[model samples]
Target: MLLAVGLAVGLALLLWARRRCPRGAGSWGLVLRHWLARRWLARAAGWQRRRLEQACKDGPRSQELLLLEGAGTPAPDAATFRERHPLTRHSADGTEPPPSPRPPLGLWALLRSCCAASSPLQGSVLYLDVLARAYPEALSPRGTARFSWARGCSLPAAAWPLPSLYCAPEAVGAAPSRAAALYVQLLLALQERALRVLEAGLLSELYDALATLRASWEGLAQDLASGGLSPHLELPQGLRHQLEGLLAPDAARAAELRAECARGWDVIARRLWPRLQVVVVAEPGSEQLYWEALQESACQGLPLYSPFYSAAGVLLGLNLWPEQPEPHYLLCPGWAFCEFLPVEPPGAEGPPDTVPLADVREGQEYELVLTAQAGLSRCRVGEVLTVAGFHYRCPLVGPVRRLSQTLSVRGEGVPEDRFYRSLRRAVAMWPGARLVDYVCAESSLMGASSGACAPHYQVFVELQGVRDLSEAQRYKLDQCLQEDFPVYKSFRLKGSIGPLRLHLVAAGAFRELRDAVGTRGPMARVLRDHRPLHFIQSRVLS
Candidate 1:
């Protein structure tokens, strides 16, 4: 009789709790899901660790030895490394002691070690009909509780919804569209290095890329303005307000930017993925994928999504959450067989050149040494990172800019990242007018009375299309810029500067310039950080 009573009470309690608690939601759900994922992650980490350890122990006999040998560079731990002038605080020698001589890792191997998971083997098709199996009511109204899992993670308003062309609900780039493809092409171009942009052979490719990007933009604009498009996405309320003052046709609600050729969600999804497609169904000779998609995108009028990762990754600095990975890039002190050096003010002997992760404090900057794995040991790759904080013995760093990317005109320093924000402000001022991309150069202006010349800022812009600007528009842009760069303001006030000048380049000018330089997209992107692009002048059809 006692057992029967206990069983009855337990059943009753369970039923009552189910009724009171939200289905598939509440605090319990979050914990349960995380527990499941962490279990898998732990298993994966163990698998990786075991393989790495085996390779370390086996030396020449390891099956992975071939992979290690391909490193083809001087061992970072070799005595020669010790012979180099010592500059690190981490060690009177420099960095962590070289790993047990088992073997060094190549770049690809190092990248793999850093990755959380290998590429998925499964096909890319979303097959919603099939996915609905376990949740037969997934699309039904009652399934609202099914997606409560979304509330678990959040992104800041700035990155919550991307400015992408609308992505398919189930999968990224399942079907090819010019709008979607153009974004990838643009991204590839953005990553290019400056030297590659000036190369002689890559010129035609650059022209083709720029033209396609423009055409795709025009076509996408038309589609967004059309009513009742399912895939079309709108900017979140917060981001919309931020860009409204600069965006044209200025529609805050009701697909306003698309209405004029403008281009997210409460919970952001990775929509820029190309599914299994390199970019929505790779074609023959995708070796030229960037160029191919760009050409197609120029002709298609489809609406597309923005590159979610690129923009979101850059803005990760806005992250306010605790425990989530802070905005950062990694430094492989040993992985690349590299070294890091301290950056000190000029004329004063700097402190210890490099500090170990455990000893590194916040606010100090360091220069990265790369390509030692590529056999260039003495090279300092120009990457500068500021220590934001520490993750245990590992330092969490925020990237400033490559040394080559910083600009100084009359000793008013402007950093690439900061200048980018100022440009966004200028974009906001001319709603309906788009600032596609721009170039800045130091220009010489003759003084009117004294016949003396001075250096001033001359900005050449390639807008979405040619549009006339009123005096107010120009001054408004200029004023917004002064607020953005404090040092620039002081220079202007001190009469050490000439008036700012803006030049509107002709349509297809950038395309012509890109082609003439024969630079690949990746190399071209490198040019973006550099203080100026002399190649850009060839395309200045104005």
Candidate 2:
């Protein structure tokens, strides 16, 4: 009896040791950590696979993703992305569904229907959708009871919405595999790095990896949410809270993480922010107060960061404004002109003859000059004699009228001389007609007779006494346009320019200009360029 009991005790001890040590048990903590790490890796892999499959099935146009994959390249750049996926060419009306929704469908059906869908890229979209769907527990809204449950599990109550996910051809073009192979590889690399950090028990590295993955996954979730690509998935609150907790112990680290996250969010926001029709600015010397007021007023409750001065610098660059100080020229960084304008001392002003910059106008010549200084500063101002007084307070700023640059169409930058010459020629072609106001736009008139799917430049002319011109005369005017601008002629052949449509406005059109403000005052007079053409004015030709 004593021998049997001793044998039983020995077996129990052996079992306990095996369970604790496993195959590679350097320590108790290492054993537990390894187990948990393995579990997480398996979970991540499963999640990734499911998401990828779903994205392929439900995305706008499967062909885009397929074509990208077939090209076996990295994702294209933004410009190239737009070139390959011309949203304008695809109908937004959604009047019809693709012929073959499935992959194995007939070639003609795929070409005619699938190719007609909204976006071509499918893998990223599918991945996001699947992530959202599979992780509902992580993404659900919280009630008081639910919040308690989440807290018990260390989950967050709120989840950030999915970001806008756009896959550019260039991004894919650079990849070894045209599809999301690189993305998957990146994910694997990140996971491997995270595992290494976990194995070494490097808390800082682990936290950093976790934060990065969290940001990436969150971005993917946001993209899916905004794209409306997948109905099953939502932002994962539980995961977000877990990520938040990872940085809770270190305040400084948390702040840095937050800043990085904010930047990522901004990238998503810039892509998804509802475009504003008008951007206004406050007048010179008042920008600081205006921006402060703006922050205090409408944006106080939001999670937005204070506008930085660098943001202002970028905007100034965009407007072709000089960065250096000049007499009479106020360095105003209003909310309209920049996302953030840091407070700085106004440098010595420009030349004594330097004029207070006048507001922008249509048909006026403007120069974007670079300053001769240690810093290459550029400013966008009206040409020497093209002074037009301020019209109205800018929508972005309360009372600033900054100059606006029209959008560029084609690789050929908008040459001021060529644009003005085109206008002059058009006016000269008409014996008695005087040009009153004009706005030119670079857009794709897709679905038009021209099968070309690229951007085209179109000029909107508001001429005096154009109401009497017959349809035949309108045709003649279009012909004259072809003769006047060689670019226009080339654009016509490329199917970039459409028939020169004339809109004769009531005399009040110019008088009503006072209602519009800022850089927009100039932009309103002339339609800024865009990829898909948007309507500029409500006034229609008779």
Deviation from native of the Cα of residue 436 in model 2, angstroms: 1.6
Model 2 segments beyond 4 Å from truth? 1-409, 414-417, 445-455, 475-481, 494-496, 517-526, 529-536
TM per candidate comes to: 0.44, 0.25
Worst 10 residues of 1 by lDDT: 141-150
Candidate 1, position 416, lDDT:
55
**lDDT of residue 532 for candidate 2:** 17
Q: What is the C-alpha lDDT of each candidate?
A: 0.36, 0.30
Give per-residue CA lDDT, model 2, range 354-435, as digits (tens).
1112223333323322121112222222212222222221101121222232334554343433454556565676667766
Candidate 1 lDDT for residue 14: 59
Alpha-carbon deviation at 429 in model 2, angstroms: 2.7
Model 1 residue 422 CA deviation in Å = 1.3
Query: Tens digit of lDDT per residue, candidate 1, span 1-542?
Result: 99999999867755654554332223333333323333343344455444433433432233122224432343344334435534322111111122112111232333233333211100001111121232232222111100000111211211101111111111211213322323333322221111011101122333343444345644333333332222343334443333222222212322332233332211001122111111111111112333333334332322111111111011111111112223343231223333356777655764545443334558888875433233343355555667776433345566555565455667776665566567668767786776555656555321242135456665667676337767676666557668987778888778787567666777756544433432221222223322235555544554
